[model samples]
Target: MSDSILDRANKGILGLKPYEPGKPIEETQKELGIQNIIKLASNENPLGISPKALNVISTQKDLNRYPDGNATNFKQKVSEEEGIKTSMITVGNGSNDLIEFVSKCFLSEGDNAIYSQHGFAIYPLAIKSTGASAIKAKAKNWEHDLSLMKELIDKNTKVIFLASPNNPTGTVLESKKIEKFLEDIPSNVAVFVDQAYFEYLEEEKHKVSFNLVENYKNLIISRSFSKAHGLAALRLGYAVSSEEIAEFLNRVRQPFNTNSLALAAGIKAIEDKDHISSSIEINKSGLKKAEEAFNSLGFEYIDSYGNFISFDSQQDSDLSFDFFLKKGIILRSLKVYEMPNHLRVSIGLEEEMNAFIETLHDYKKALDAG
Candidate 1:
């Protein structure tokens, strides 16, 4: 046999690019020798975890014992709240875990998975990891063009992933439009909706995904405690779908996929309405601050419903990304999403946003000086 280790790897793995997360504050401090770092890159909750969620950590005991393999309590709590049956919910380490579970369960080499052009990097990564073909439907104004996405659906289409208020761009596809799109698609093809930022949306836009799950047997809706719930560190998320879809997802999901800490904190996190409310209220204020500055600076930005925003860079995006990095700020560059001229910033606390606004102004001044 040939002694080539490369030959043993899957062909799909050869071409795949790993997901790039936002630079961590600790990493920035070590690399740049900067202590005062503010990160507006990963779309995390700037206000931090709720007191109720925090209170559970002190009570957690028996680290030697494994977590509930079936996530029974998680399903029951979610069922009580969502009016969805316990059989219809599957808990995971995070919403991304559920997304990957779906791909691994159903997709194969000949199968093709559809996603928006500017979709989350994890979508294609998960699809490709399973040796499935990833098809990109061109986006309109950085929003998913459902018509274009639907047209590409064919015999081999196993999954179509949609993101409302999609990451990076933050454009929303209306509930009615999504409903209509659901009406038009064939039942055999599964449509997975990532509503990871669901709690961050306004009252009118809330229930956009859940309202459709009951009517569509093939639909899967994913939600997270990472965003508005301020439990990103716990990495807890849940998905709602027909009992049939949840069954398949559970089959591929690893045993005890969700840790004990995430489950305990998540149960408390979901109950803390006050904490969620404050996150949204503060995010609204922070978004307004960033947008006003972007407007005054003459940068065009997509109208966003999520906790983060991306705007066009007047100069090379790399220059601006570096400019912010050197000043103890971490921002995301959208080059990986094929939008090389834009930069994404997650909404932060008042002081963090103030620092960002000041640094942004300095960058603008530097551009002018050059």
Candidate 2:
């Protein structure tokens, strides 16, 4: 008999746990035999896609031809919009792809990458897959502690992952703090700032300066069309960096990584300013509603700047998750992020958010009686 396949797998692959995505509304409905299920798990745009984006996708006729291998049009549009040269932009299947690309381009066996304790799950996964050490710097107040991150940086450190509105916790680091951190880091090490929820932030709080890319050759800023653009289904994201860094990332990127439909949708989505504004307005209102509901219910939650909030269930998160599922409501359990008593809910339409709040109240009442 042949040796066990596990024995032949890479060392990194052996210890890695696959990413668990939020349950789909349709899947839950089929399993529970319930209709009209509400999903506030994944942080998806509740406003749906812009009509302009839909128009572009509907006119696509060429399915057999390969996508632009270089993603020329998409890059050019983004470059003009962001005031960056086309040479400094690299398109990906999603921002997640860019994260992996950076990891592959720099990390290797014996190298180490640093990230905050409660940072995005993909950071560690991408780093570990490269057979590199994933260093978790202790977070301060559930946010990135730049000083702590600098302390963890050793000679083996090759990359650092920083998410402004960090996932799972929704903690944001101020722009000035990040600027100071960047000034102190060594030039050889690369810093990747993932800004997937950037458009959701209020105008006054748009503290991140993309122009920093021009000054720091090692800084890479990755953004996604999936969130604010309502193009998650299309899966388009891009990275902005110095020409040298972008060239390195492009060298490692697979050709035609983004499909043609996604390319077309992204082009239109970027120009749909009104739709984006509407999405942000809805999210702000929904977030306020959720905060008020959580406060009245006496549930502790993180102060969020993103489109989701991580709240303490005050009970076993798995049990809470199961309860919500049975009630036709889907929320995210934070056990994978090491917060077993915390659950995250994405901001949805007013009616959908109300449904979740009512269901949660019922769950709390039931727990109190028991």
Per-candidate Cα lDDT values, in order, are 0.89, 0.90
* Clash counts for the predictions, in order: 0, 0
**How do the residues 1-370 of candidate 1 rate in per-residue lDDT, one tens digit apiece?**
8858887788778898778899999989999998999999999999999999899977999879999988887778888888778998989898999999989987989999999999989999999888899999999878899999999999999999998778988888778888888899998888998898888777574347565778998899999889999888888898898888899999999998899888988888889989999999999999999999999998888888899999997777898899999999999999999899899999999999999999989988898899
Per-prediction TM-score: 0.98, 0.98
> Which candidate gets the maximum lDDT versus the true structure?
2
Per-residue lDDT, model 1, residue 312, is 91
Tell me the tens digit of each residue's lDDT in model 2 across 210-318. Answer: 7998888889998999888999988999999999999999999999899999998999999999999999988898889989988998899999989899999988999
Quote the positional error of residue 298 for candidate 2 in Å: 0.6
Worst ten in a row by lDDT for model 2: 200-209
Instruction: Provide the clash count, candidate 2.
Output: 0
Q: Which stretches of candidate 2 lie over 4 Å from their true place?
A: 1-3, 203-206
- lDDT for model 2 comes to 0.90
